[model samples]
Target: MPPRERDTARTRRTVLDAAARTVAKQGAGVSLDVIAREAGVSKSGLLHHFRSRDQLLLALAQDQVDTFAAEVRAAVDPADHAAGRLVRAYVKAIFDSLGDDTAISEHLLLSAALSTVPGVAEILQRDARQWEAAFTSDGLHPDRVLIITKAADGASLATLYEGGSNPAALERTRELLLSMTRGEGSFTG
Candidate 1:
């Protein structure tokens, strides 16, 4: 790659990392100027890549979603039962992602974007449908199963971000989701 392209890539990383840290520390109200300063770059440099705050927020969410998707694909055996593999892989990936501090930032950003931006929720809904379809081949009721999955994920995320120090909690949640997916236990309260 050319030096200019490499430099641009580095700058983008710096901006993204700084944005993550800023949001992690200061919540979703963090300004681009603060992010630029935290990244050791000028505000213009940051804006060059993002163009606008909405663009930056969307990019951040995309990065996190892509990361989770990649991890799920890597962890599960697709040749196995597709539904079972997707459920197991998703559970494991959610747990694994919780350990990364930057994930909190990603979560907050994603939440803010979906709540404040029109049509962003549609993107999430579409992804959820895709996830449900991926797990449907196991004879599971995709809608019900996905509801349980999202509930479990929401609970795990709450614990993961609240500074609660317990690996057992994550493990237990993972096992619970696995059991539900395996038809070994009821997911309902």
Candidate 2:
């Protein structure tokens, strides 16, 4: 009988998904053996897909950033004409990820741990350039964009330790940020 063919794409997806779950629960320093075990593959198999631990972490980080960026881009409303449309989209994406009642919310928790990996920083910085250009050219004042985005970031941080966010508070903050983005609110009375 012939040997079974390896499903490269499915295998890579499984490995990345398992890595995300393990890394979220344990941290980036977790052993590749552990990831392989979680992934139901041998360490050799995992190494075959990723040359080294850092390489795997780098791929995971890039995937995380790219996924979040896509979420933000999708949230953008082309007809809204809001002052901070991009920032609004960003704020919406952050809240949406935190609000997810599904397994995918693990990505947010995983992201908090990904920063512990050395190669992850470069991934984030490189991705930040795209956001920088979008928000800088976005119709809102730079100060407004900065505050709205930072507030959303701080709120999203709650997911790091809590594994999720307070729904009511998160919704309220989401609305407030959206309003601020639309020039309908202010930080001061």
Candidate 3:
């Protein structure tokens, strides 16, 4: 890319990273001035990139969803059954995020706060619907797919909130969920 474009991208990334950390630490009500200070950019510079507070929040929310989707895609294996691949990818993504110390996961955990901003919730909701449709369209029964997905989500939430290692339980739950996807076990919920 051109130098000017590269610098612009770099600046944007720095600002976004700072914004995520500030919001995660300070909640969604944090001021743009604080974010600019954190990013080491002038408030005018921050505004030049994001235009407005709502715009910045929307960008942050979209970035979170995009990052999550990329993680899931990386974890997925094309040879696996579609349903199994989706569930495994999601579970793996959650675990991977939990293990990361870069604060991206913390930023994502602020989705509830982001949702309060005008367009952020819609972005998240759209991603959820897209994932739901993907799972439902897989050959597996929709109810089973949903149950497995919900279970994984619950496990992820528990791990995120509790903040500790319970490798045995997590492994067992992963195995059980994978087994269900493979048609090797029955689960009702």
Candidate 4:
């Protein structure tokens, strides 16, 4: 990439990171001035990248979704069966995120975004529908898929709220979820 483009990308990333931390710490009502200060940019500079507060919030939501999707794709294996790969990838992604400090911070940011942004919930719902369709198309039962998805989400949320979880329990849960994808175990909860 050109130096100009790299700088632009870096500026945008820095602004978004600052916005996420601000939102997570100060709630969704955090001011643009605060974010600008946090990002070490002037208000006009922040505006150059995001036209308005709503725009910035929307971008934050989309960025979080995109980042999580990339993580899931990275965890998927080409050699696995399509259904198993999808299920395992989803489970692995959740586990990976739970263990990541950045992911925990982002999760808090996401929560703030959902609560503050008008259309953010729709965006997430659309993403969830897409994942559901992909899993069903890959031959997994939709019910089972939803179960596993909700379980992972719930566990991740719990960990976020509680600061952390027992490592052994988390590992056991990961193994159980993976086994479900392989059709070797059932989810009791």
Candidate 5:
């Protein structure tokens, strides 16, 4: 890429990183001025890329989803068990997300918005369904596996973000989730 284009891209990335840090530290009350300072960019330059704070937050959410999908897709094993692959990918993502302030901030904002915004979860849910269908095609019951996996993921993400390394709790939850997914017993809500 040309120098100017590269510079612009770098600036945008810096601003996004800064915004993610600010949001993670201060929640949604974070200010654009703080983000600009964190990025070491002038307010004018930051505004040139993201016209408004809402736009910046939206971009952060989109980037988090895109990065997550890419990571899971890359981690999935094509030849081995798909259900196991899904669980591994999900567990890895949830625990690993502890180190990612961007994803943390993005999820906090996106989940809140999902309650108020109709289409917020539509695309992500569709993508999740498609992935679950792939597992079902391998002979596992999609609905049962998806429910357990989603619950496991939720619990893992919550623990990780809360900085609570409850390994025993996580291990028991994982075992239960795997057992239910494997249809080993009569599991219920």
Candidate 6:
């Protein structure tokens, strides 16, 4: 790409990152002026990228999903051709994000913080449908897939509520969920 285009893309990313950080810190009620300030871009410059606050929020919502999906993709176990490969990777992504670091971790927590805003839920639901299909077809039983995903989700939510994650509890939950995906234990346990 050309330098100008690359600069444009970089500026867009900067704005999105700033918006996520701002929303995560200040909630959805935060103003565009603040977001632009946080991004180090003028209001006009931010508008050139996002157009409107809702547009920026919607873009942020999509960015959040994309970031987590990228994280899961990165964690995929290429050596494992059996079932639970995608799911185990997903489980890893969730637990990995609980550490309160990494850009991906911040997005996971930011997404939870933005869950109630308009457009965010629909974006999540759409992404979720795709994930559900992928999980169900990965050679795992439907029950195992559901149970494992929900458990990982609950762990993420617990991190949101608790303002951080408990390493020991997350470890235990992570162990149980990964085991279930691999068909090593009962889901009822």
Distance from true location, Cα of 45 in model 4, Å:
1.0
lDDT of 5: 0.67
The order of the candidates by lDDT, greatest first, is 6, 2, 4, 3, 1, 5
Q: Where does model 1 exceed 4 Å of error?
A: 1-4, 99-114, 117-119, 137-139, 157-165, 186-189
Candidate number of the best TM-score = 4
Q: In what order do the candidates fall by TM-score, top score first?
A: 4, 6, 3, 2, 1, 5
Tell me the spans in candidate 4 whose CA falls farther than 4 Å from its real position: 100-106, 160-163, 186-189
Residue pairs clashing in model 6 are none
Shift in Å, residue 152, candidate 5: 1.8
Per-prediction CA RMSD (Å): 3.7, 4.3, 2.6, 2.5, 4.4, 2.8
Q: Which of the two, 1 or 3, has more lDDT?
A: 3
Residues forming the 10-long window of minimal summed lDDT in candidate 1: 110-119
Question: After best superposition, candidate 1 residue 38: deviation in angstroms?
Answer: 1.4
Estimate the TM-score of every prediction.
0.75, 0.82, 0.85, 0.89, 0.68, 0.87
Tell me the tens digit of each residue's lDDT in model 1 across 1-189. 999999998888888877767765666667899989999998898999999776776676566566667888887866666446677777777777666545654565546644555545666677667766677765666655776568656854564466652667667777877777666654443
Q: After superposition, how far is residue 121 of candidate 4 from its true place, in Å?
A: 1.7
- Please give, for residues 44-77, the per-residue lDDT of candidate 4 as tens digits: 9999999999999988888888888999999989
lDDT of candidate 4? 0.81
Q: List the residue pairs that clash in candidate 3.
A: none
lDDT of 5 by residue, 21-59 (tens): 776666655788998999999999999999988778777
Q: In angstroms, give how far residue 87 of model 5 lies from its true place.
A: 4.4
Better of 2 and 5 by lDDT: 2
Kindly report which residue stretches of model 2 are placed more than 4 angstroms away from their true locations once superposed: 1-6, 100-109, 159-164, 186-189
Q: Show model 5 residue runs off by greater than 4 Å.
A: 1-3, 78-84, 98-139, 157-163, 175-189
